[model samples]
Target: MEDNHIHSISSKSACKVTDDICLPDTNWPRLVIVGGGFAGLALVEKLKNKKVQVVLFDKNNFHQFQPLLYQVATSALEPDSIVFPFRKQFNGYKNVVFRLAVVEEIQPTSNIVRTNKGDVHYDYLVLATGTTTNFFGMDTVADNSLGMKDIRDSLNIRHMMLQNLEQAAITCDDEERDTLTNFVIVGGGPAGVEMAGALAEFCKYILPKDYPEYPSTIMNIYLIEARGELLSSMSDKASSKTLKYLEDLNVNVLLNESVSNYDGSKVITNRDNIIMAKNLIWTAGVKGQFPKGIDKKYVVRGNRIKTNPFLMVEDYKNIFAIGDIAAVITEKTPKGHPQVAQTAIQQGKYLGTSILNIIKNKPIKPFEYHDKGSLATVGKRKAVADLGKFRFGGYFAWLLWSIVHLMSISGFRNRLMVGFNWAVSYFTYEKSNRLIIRNFNKPSESKSTINSQPAVKKITIND
Candidate 1:
């Protein structure tokens, strides 16, 4: 069959609706993907030269390498090195069309998707919207702490840390200086562990050179976890080794503790323990983020859309879900697959073939996820890996982590830039340019700091 005969719509006419997004005229089956994360991009790659007209919608014009977001947050790498433009990625793929728009609603009955920019109809819809920082309804913590989910969030952290360190040097009061230099990181996951380690290294190496007035010991690093162990998702051996590595780097690891509130300067834990610090990083949890319109019953825990084994949304044949936003509910896998890059990538590839097969009226198999192991780095020359039966940590694991991440980045230029930066940092222990280009103030500090640079709060710690 010819491409024009695949759909009922004519190939010569454009979208006629007044609020419709302008798209190329095509009679091929329209595969509209709502996100450009790992899953969406993988699916796009699979259908590159195919007859399907792939339309990708995302809020940002670029796809972020989320695994290396911590490096960006800690100044080990520049933001651009880890984020690739969507247009650049779709250079050779003629069938793919990239659109920068936030999907507002999904009208399944009308086969249309409403967005902030305009609406676009889809023959087959896929939701790969991914996850967002989950504050767990703690408004105070959400307002004060920064979550390392996006590139902008990473930059905000860098600016906040640099600005605070500079303020610490200018303050004459001893108590205020301590609060400014102290860092509190909530969560013991990979992001939290890596962030704590990076901050500790910054305090150990950069603090002395940048600000010689204060001792490096003045900058304290803390990693707090609600659970008793770090990397609870990984092996016990990996967890113990990660904790040890952080401690060796002078990071105060606080286990079985959870943050209750944060009023910008003080971090109050559920156990009534208070830590006076101006900087707080939250890496605790994430919930799926997607547009409204789906039935409430289809939504499950973690705010994910419940889907069948074929990666299709329940009771909907044309609509599908993938990546972190999808919860493939089955008897064997109750909650769904792990919300990671590997799972997303695999699902995208599988669904790509399945969708094409469905279009051809062929048999489609169930989506199966193969566990590809996991790796988490603590600091330079320190990492833990759980590769099936082979569980290891330290130098070799760190090397494997480095290679895997370097090769996983989107563009060749980005990979080269990151590899070069890593090599330089490895030899000299020096980070990228630490410049504060923007003024990022927490919600509590925003009003007071408006019209002023950084409102250096001089609050005395209560004993």
Candidate 2:
């Protein structure tokens, strides 16, 4: 880090101490978790009352269920459903303590983790920090586009979409209004597809009732996929069906078309064409959010940390990585498992049992991934499901998808709320909670602060 980039520093430091009372002698085999996402929460949940004392920490105080995050971003669901409070989840539980802290560094040699608040020693560490939305090494994409990783990002996207529609009404120029009304969702994967569908539905049902001045056709929703089809992970028939459903909903599904550039207004794709857009929802891909001090050699494709079949890091005993962060390399499975919540949950269960086995000097079992199949929703009465021998699309698929998701949700209250919301939306063709919150921020509006100039390298908190 360069000194020129350093700002607002204090020359002197203060040290405060209690009544010289010695710190509580921590129990042996202290497990420190860096994140509170899918994998980290699962790990602690499995070992809620185990021998090891668990200290789970995250920047935010909640565990965000990412699959439903797109719905939150598109204003289909409230924030409470997607985000589960970490403390509330572990309340009155023994051997588990949740801490809110920003993890700054991981000193693996010393078996310690540092944070903005303080440092803690760990007998074993689990790096389940999960993955961030991959912008494909494009700086402009990182800076200009809206990422759908966290709740704040989701709410910001929702606000931006609504604000653009409102702004479109007052604008006199038709060109400017069109630009504001148009929305481009990069990556035709499940997140992109869901968002595109929600936005398209908004245009059909919500917009007509609210913005009578703007017709449904005038508000265009474009889904850009670099691949030849959407939901490429699903069956070929499912992909075709999803495309058909999207096309019927009036979403422009642009397949095999890569976006070349986005200057916050015009999104130039491939060559010879450009789409005037306001919102650029980026859900392209994800790379592991590896914590510091892990050996660079262990980091493999997708920036994932390599692990053994036992879910332990290759060169280390005791230390383990799971969820989206760990890449288990095997002859049968090469590219690690898909970074899904279910895989993480299962891995956490296995790893917790494995830890118990290790303590008892018992043989550890290999972690095997169960294929429960994958399903995604495209709006009311529309979805696709792939279950190996069983593959389906359209209305029945949507019902199955809803039931599965509702049952899979973390808590009972959440499942009930989401169920109610879906039921109402299904019947009315309306998505409630479209109200915009917080200070105004838009995807099209350039934040000069983030793009001011070449940031003179600084040793910030992330460093």
Candidate 3:
């Protein structure tokens, strides 16, 4: 059976001199959505069977489950378990088309989006480009440290970690071996905490058994945070418990200290500590990421676009911004809602309904975010959760966290695979997917190789 649902426009044809690649005529409004993250997917799901011809654009063809990316980095789960292809996800949506292209700029005056492939006109445009790793203007850190933003980054971390271990096993120099084994993670956010815990678990269970050549005691895992507490957004109880959990797992928690600089080998902090480590996983912060054409006035702190109560971008009714890239300021959320999956998902669903209301000439409702609580797991059975005033930390919280994340995953197959992996790891204490499929180099070495590639083309659907 031929798969006519998704098609790719070849690079040669995409680069042809044409005014605009012709699109199928439709009486309904054509909606162009930029991104395939949590918010964009939710919006597309809501617009299913609606009076709209939706075209979704993303550089990648898959929607990544970001919350569980750490597991991939630590080899706890394979990459396939956390990523779902867009074509498979929207196979039944006949009115929707998925394009794999890099959006260069937006021409708001003409309602056309200029991409690497070609120009695409739309009746309404939605920007859910999400956020990128923010280095806070620290060039040294940006150049030297590894980030956990995407699956590629996770795989790079995994490869670097295993490669470093392999090198440590062969090196005779004690200092070099120590640097190879030393792991420093900046930012005590959920990603950093989970990574630290996972690394510690590896040292405890897997390292001793798998790599007997190198002693596990020599390996050092450090969690650094500028703030005094971990999981600052959560309640104090949750924060304290999380700190305790990390300490119990033998992770060195550095509080109230900021990374001053990293020269690719040494991690220099504001305090007296200057640690040597080749691998530094940075999860400190993230800022809004979108293409050009949005006015500077509309962009606020953290590089986010200012959106109204209806999630429409300021000064443009037909353009909307949601997810981590949007700053929807309200009295309750003066600084905008926390950049979490729930916020994006809620806003996306609301914006979809609002678009339909606008089409029907009916009143549109404002978006209201209901806090669904927060959860963070440190080690196997050590976790913390904050639900309103109720706070809990222990094995129950870990189980609850696992169940919630498993249910939140995209497909049943992914959930089952992840559940099975967790069960196996629980009993056997092993991470089977540690193979380095591709070798990873430092950012400076890899940047030139990536820049040589041509622009991505679109994935077209048959009429």
Candidate 4:
């Protein structure tokens, strides 16, 4: 087969093709990747400048560093700091191209993907679409509470918190003030724990200084977990230490309790315990997110696509999945690999080489996951880590967490921005991005639903 065996519409004549996204003419096998999260980007990195022409499709053009999204939500860093443009990442990589479009459907039979912009054919397809916030089919909770799944969610949390605090200041009634100031974080996972810790810090360090009228205890931080302990995925030591860390920070750790319902202002737990809070952040669960056209038979628990050990969807040789969307089911691992950055990165890189070998008809081995340990931070100078035969917490663990995350960010400039902010906050306890530039309204309800419901009273600034 020669290089020109496959002919693509030239750049000048791309408009003539109906329902097709304009792409550079290429003879190399086109690898169409959906989503640009950890796994997809890893594959992109591995295949850059390779013989395969890669077309990366994502709704957002930037790659977000998810582990630190809590910081962004808590205003420790800006959105731009955690996001890197795909074009900037692909600079000098001639074989790679990125398109900003939402994939609406996957037509495996036609070897094409239909996006909101246009359709594009693929020689091979990979789904790294990742997961979205899972509310367990609770519409009320889904509408009222904020999720920590993306940069937008983080921004929403930040705005919700700031606006609620401002409302707390405006109210005359004590009960309404309490409802406005209290914070409820559902889920005992790493995200919820980190968010609770960060909010606790905000209440402790930033509240009294920013608002002299209110005491430091005006804001209450509650962390609710359905599980018996925090960080259930980690070892017993790590879990215990994490609980201790949050407790010391005055976070109301509610273990063995689940949120039964939330009506925008009140949190009702399964035990019938009621907590009044206007700001609720949900980090409880996530389900696979991808375009339609995937057979329901291949879908498993958590809505993930079932794939073989080689990372190929069962019965579909040319279609594959990676990252959070992929559930590689095997006897040893009945569910799937952990939906973490490490698993996704490894899978992406593995599949990169695997795809090239596949094109060349070379043999490939089964996909195997190597556990790289887990790290979760409660707040500044506090974290827990679980490594092989070694579990630890406190300052040293926090240091390890910081170093690992700093090195894991996408770009050097982003790394620098985060490192600088962390350094300033490590000593000063400062969060620089607290300005409420925009009013945030929940997607599911009217703006009035989130407003403070107490009677308004007039008080002069000096009064």
Candidate 5:
């Protein structure tokens, strides 16, 4: 086994090996994993020290802790606190290698992955590409609204939020100011609810102190959901509790309402209520994001690749699909498992062992998802949890949520930073990382204007 190395595959080295861009030749079977999310990471962990050459490919160099992305968007935690470098993570794994590349296509017949850099041959391939925000064919909404799917998206939301606040403070037009301050979030899922709560907290605590000129009361937070209840996947008790929690936080929970369209400055709902909001965060839905080359028949609803019981893609034995991109249709889970981190983690670990079993000519076990629980935090000291027969909410659940998330985070430094931030916010209501490093302009705005705009100077808030 050789020490793990991180490489950037070059386009010139597509089919053949070159000095600058080449994977070490080995007799061991090469396992190529596409993605650096929960599943891919878990799979790598399981494959550590195994009789396999593992190569993980991802566009980004870091594995983002997606569960806490809302915290980053709401300025509760910095981006670095939720992201871990791939190289640092797999440092001791001698059999593994990490590559920074965007996978362009999957050639299953040839057992090769075509990336932007080059094409790499593989003995077995794992598709854990994860999910991307689904705009549901609404081009206008997709163009205008911000989606919180990754660190960049979260940072965009934060920048837009602070920029909107600054604009609201300077704008003479009352309607424009209202539009700037009104935060509209589509989808009542955990992300939307958490965002609404965080924004509500910002209105209740941070705004009055930071921007005294603009009344905090003017900053309205709306959480719109087409469904009747929030946390629709959770138990009714959890959903009801989450609704109450959001309401208590002064987050306007607009149930049974769908967004018809979002023009840059206004949100038109199906219920005929027009919301003036410059910042619209869409957490409505997600669809599996996979590269081309797979048969369209294997791609099912939600853009997920259909897989058999062993987590193998339909009609393929060596290629497997896991995480949000995989729809492992079973008798019990006909629609596939919930697109959550746990499902991906478990599936990745299970498939890793299954692959080992295949290599050893042993019986491969079927993948089974263990439902640990579902949890969502609404506001400070307010959350709901559904743990099978046990259902609870409020302060205890909030504490549990915090601890679990803190522990689940990637690194020790990240855990410390996030915990410290949470403590600071809990003890004294303040968001320290609210500095707008980048001036975020509307998507329709000219790129030149965006580039020419001066960066926001740092402001020290006096106690």
Candidate 6:
């Protein structure tokens, strides 16, 4: 068969024409990772000073310590404390390059990735692209509510919260003021529960003294959820303990109900009840983030990439998936493992060693995740931790949670700064850096981002 004959055969076989997926200059092993979050960073760190060329891309230039982002938004921590520059993370490593670009898709057929900046190629591709907020296809919820995902999102929420208070101070109508004062946070997950607590703390210990004009009781922080209880992933004891803690702190906990709609000023629930509010915080749900080029059937529960226990997408060699995007399909985990930082970290470490072994023609070790535990803190002296069989709550739980999170930061400098912020916030009961700077897109940004892309051009990777 001639070259043209093979070309005709290939083109005829598929509906969409893919010319080729091979890299042009494939001299050295080039590894291009799609995310700068937990799993991607872990792989880069583990492979630092190794024998390969590494390139990392993300929309943001900083590696955020997400667990503490709620604190930043609620004025308990500074933005810089929770965010570490991505360049600084790999300063000593000579084999790594970082790019601030939005990944449009991975063209696995062409062995290229299409992005906003341009295309990129790799000998090996890693998909660590993390999850994003899931509104369950609700348009009003998507249109009116504010989400707590990245630093920018958190900052926006803070601005809206404080702005509402300032607005309420001048308004004469009690009903209107009450509407502005109600802060409704959707979801019972860690982010939602933690935000509700921090907001309550602000209302109780800080807001009263700061805003003498407004009554302290005027601040209504509601935590709404669709489940029967908060922290459904944790033990019964932890959930019950957390509920009591939130209630004690004046957090209005609503369970087994959901946000039906938000008309920019009031929240409509499934129970036909409406709560008037100026600010709505969405920490409700998340879905697995998969780039293009893979078969849609591979995307399973939570939109995760269907993968084997070895962390490889089924039937694909040289390409691997990790972090929140990759779902390790197993009988035990029919859907997938819980999407968490620890799970991503362990997978990255395992994959790092496995890749090295494969290079040396050694036996490959399959990746297995170990469930350490989970914790969510609700303001000062109120927290919960579940460590396998053991469970604890209250001040000690808060202490443990703080220590673990601080230590988990990639660099010591970040850990130190975060630790300092925590100490100051503990004593002062005030978040120092509360500047409302930029006005982010009000959930409508997604529409603009999706529309801005080119009409499916062949993306190339310039090595």
Structure candidate 1, residue pairs in collision: none
> On residues 269-350, what C-alpha lDDT tens digit does candidate 6 reach at each position?
7775567777899999998776778888888878889888888888777688999899888888877888889999998888
Report how far residue 77 has shifted in candidate 1, in Å. Answer: 0.7
Per-residue accuracy of model 4 over 274-301 as CA lDDT, tens digit each: 7887888999999999999899999999
**Per-model TM-score versus the true fold:** 0.94, 0.90, 0.91, 0.94, 0.92, 0.88
- What C-alpha lDDT values do all the predictions have? 0.89, 0.79, 0.86, 0.88, 0.86, 0.79
* Backbone clashes (count) for model 2: 0
- Weakest ten-residue segment in model 4 by summed lDDT: 454-463
User: What TM-score does candidate 3 get on C-alpha atoms?
Assistant: 0.91
After TM-score superposition, the amount by which residue 379's alpha carbon in candidate 1 deviates from its true location, in angstroms, is 0.4
Worst 10 residues of 6 by lDDT: 5-14
Clashes per prediction? 0, 0, 1, 0, 0, 5
Tell me how candidate 4 scores on lDDT.
0.88
Q: lDDT tens string, model 5, 368-434? A: 8899999999889999999989999999999999999899998899899999999999999888999
- Clash pairs detected, candidate 5: none
CA shift of 221, model 3, Å: 0.5
> What TM-score would you give candidate 2 relative to the actual structure?
0.90
Tens-place lDDT per residue, model 1, 26-94, is 778888999999999999999887878899999999999999888887788999999999999999787
Better of 3 and 6 by TM-score: 3
Who is ahead in lDDT, 2 or 5?
5
